[model samples]
Target: MQTDNSYANTFATDSDAELVLPSHPAQAREPQWLAFNAELAGQLGIPESLHTTAAGLGLYSGTELPDWIQPVALGYAGHQFANFVPRLGDGRALLLTEIIAPDGERFDLQLKGSGTTPFSRGGDGKAPLGPVMREFLVSEAMHALGVPTTRALAAVVTGDWVQRDEAQPGAIITRVAKSHLRIGTAQFVAHKITQGADESLRQAFADYVIARHYPLSKDRKHPYRALLRQIIDQQAHTVALWMSLGFVHGVMNTDNMTLSGETIDYGPCAFMENYDPNAVFSAIDRAGRYAYQNQPGIALWNLARLAEAWLPLLAKSGESQQQLIEAATELVHEFPIRYEAYYDQKMAFKLGLNSVTAETQALTRDWLSLLQDHALDYTQSFRQLADTLETNVEHFEKMQSWAAWQQRWHKLLTLQGDSDAVVSARMRQHNPAVIPRNHWVEAAIKQTVASGDLTIFNELTQVLRTPYDVVPLELSRYAEPAAPEKRVTRTFCGT
Candidate 1:
């Protein structure tokens, strides 16, 4: 497999590492089967020959690290559901190597559920089959839906079982991302500063992040502040897209928030069925802190944590400490405005508007209000809006609430001077015809675990690849919401 040992060559240390620790050797039990992502592997410049068999996959999940690969378990700190955890690192995940694509783009090739590392705390560092497959499906689905996310490269059955609640098959997912740097990574460096580490440590980590993800920052006058602004912008756009698709990330912990702006961890995440602003599906999120509507605010909060970590670095750049703090604080405060702008544009497109105005915003708000009041399916409501606009005139001449909303939408379209064809096309592009429904996901997981049948899993993956397209009527079952008895109300973390 193609590899770049740049990270190890640049950052390895004997005692006081800036970010990662030496990976503890752990064995993958009876590595039996492997599945490679041909598409993603090709994108990362992996030759077709390297990914065709179990041996190729073994290079990533195997007990022995190849000469070109140096596995390291990273260190970080995070606020979990608003509670600060001083240290939370790659407990069960390890960065194997960086892959340099033909086009010069670099990506991290990491293994989740590989085995325990020093940061594994007191728990066994292994992943069950169900969560592994969940990530494979959802991450691929998110990519297909045009959301920024960590893509899955391969999945392997380790021929072992992990006892979560009961003995379940253990598996490993090979995840690929632009980088693994997170807000918590910055927090870890900041914490080190308080523990008597010199400013050089923080600067080294920050420079590494800039080189890896934001190389352009090196050209800016205030590169550190520029990096912060760039990260904030990426996150703002990412969270807006998540909201547009009704995706609840479930856990918006600082550790899970990547500086690369990709959706990293997928544990307990779900798509909203009924349109409630406060929708949450994580089993552990009893307080609804990372609910659907709360995501933007929580993202800002996470970015604030990142800003806190970078303050010292910014101050060391010849700027007065207080000046740097005020500047960083101002940049963070721009997140809300940036998030709203992206969200407003997306909402306008969903409403089939050529332009967003005060009236359009009000109309969008009222439409959401209608959906929440009636507990309407979030995806279908917008997906069906274009159809409802035409059908209301023929079937519901009496003007029901939906029909009235349609009239207002049509008037707004007229005001914008966009033809029906133009507006309909815009709406279809923004609103998906289907999503990875919670119940369908649960059903697929149950079928795979209980019967070793991958029929449902394969079919669901295929359907979600073209989520915005109208599927065949025979496959319409995939688009439908869950039956009352089959609905999955809550989701759990893989750990």
Candidate 2:
């Protein structure tokens, strides 16, 4: 990672105009990307500088790309969301390698839009610039806001065009993450139980996750059970964090779910504006299956498939897999309680409440009810909670529930012995004043394509980088949704 000043200096493109990608033939002139990954023999910490040398480009300036990418397309099976889809794997993506950081922790460098694979499923395996930048910006934003996510290492505009809806140029994003694999990968092997390689595959998958993520994940022979429990807890919080932030992950398929529990796929995803739990933004998500409120359920449903994959390992001699199934069932069933508790804690922090309890759930519900009535901006209300000193509710037209919630909030702070300053500080930490609102992003995208002027895009990126901070007045270009004339109801998946 480079210093902020240095990164800013490098981000400037006018002086180094030719150094950056320009408006040209995207399809023919695009660079053919090469993978830098871990080798099959478990060679680790391949310095990134080697990749720059191989690519023969200065896109990284003096920085380097990792060496020895043991690139492999992992095999997996998933339930799409809830309904079982028998076969699903790395259709078009590839997990390049695991980078062992200076601290000895590993993160995956997976390439999206690189090229097609055996699992192409009759679709072109390429990415456009818009979605590439979207993943980079939003993933980094999530990281800054204390959410675990795959970091975008770099975005390269492949000067090639990929035809989906329109003929658009292709690009590749080097996404660094805790891991590229999912429980679905494990399920892919487990579901083929009759193949006799089932047990071998399950053991290998468990070992891989433990070795890469939780070195201590397997202290005992049956640590798979423990590892499974740990993943359940992490995924619970991850989804709740997404919900708290008003994020709608257009596609929450099994293979898209990461084993390390970070928010992974960004295709066709959008941030909500007027906060509807049922809001569907993905052009492909005609049904509200993977909606905002539906995220947690979908997460658990995906986890269930993973659990089923682990059933063979859980089943012992002649007693049958149901014993293992019962144990797995218990773990999956715990998702709601974990989610609700985590959600309440997150919601409490958003509202500046320190001493939250079952009683406070009423106040929280009432606040959301008011939010729905007023169609308030979800991000704004929590961000403004601390700033507003009025005892009565006058921010919006409605006042009854707001007034009551405010009173309860004030009372809770007093009971918890916390000052207004402390509560405000806490609220600011949890509540982001701004997100990559759909309308603003769409406008920025249109502006870039229509005029090739990246001023609005760059400005929004700046605001998004510090999502928790208040946006400046000059940056108000990103503050609101597009009016009736500019609204984009559907977001496209840059396939």
TM-score of each: 0.95, 0.85
* Model 2 lDDT per residue over 1-495, tens place: 210111112212322111111111112254533222222113334345535454422232111233433344445667664666656555556665455655556666566776665555676667776787677667767776777788766556566777877877667777777666677666665665545542454676676677666666678666777777778888888888988888888889887788888888787788777757788888877788888888898888888887877776655566656676777798788888888888888888887776559867777887787777777778777777778743433575365566666667677778888777888888888898778777777666667556657776678777877777777988865766566676667887686
Rate residue 24 of model 1 by lDDT. 50
Give the TM-score (vs. native) of candidate 2: 0.85
Q: Which model scores highest in TM-score? A: 1
Error of 1 at 437 (Å): 1.0
Off by over 4 Å in 2: 1-28, 32-67, 81-83, 196-198, 316-320, 390-393, 397-400
Model 1: lDDT equals 0.84
**CA RMSD for every model?**
2.1, 9.0
lDDT of 1 by residue, 358-418 (tens): 9889998988988887777889878877776455433233424766776787788888898
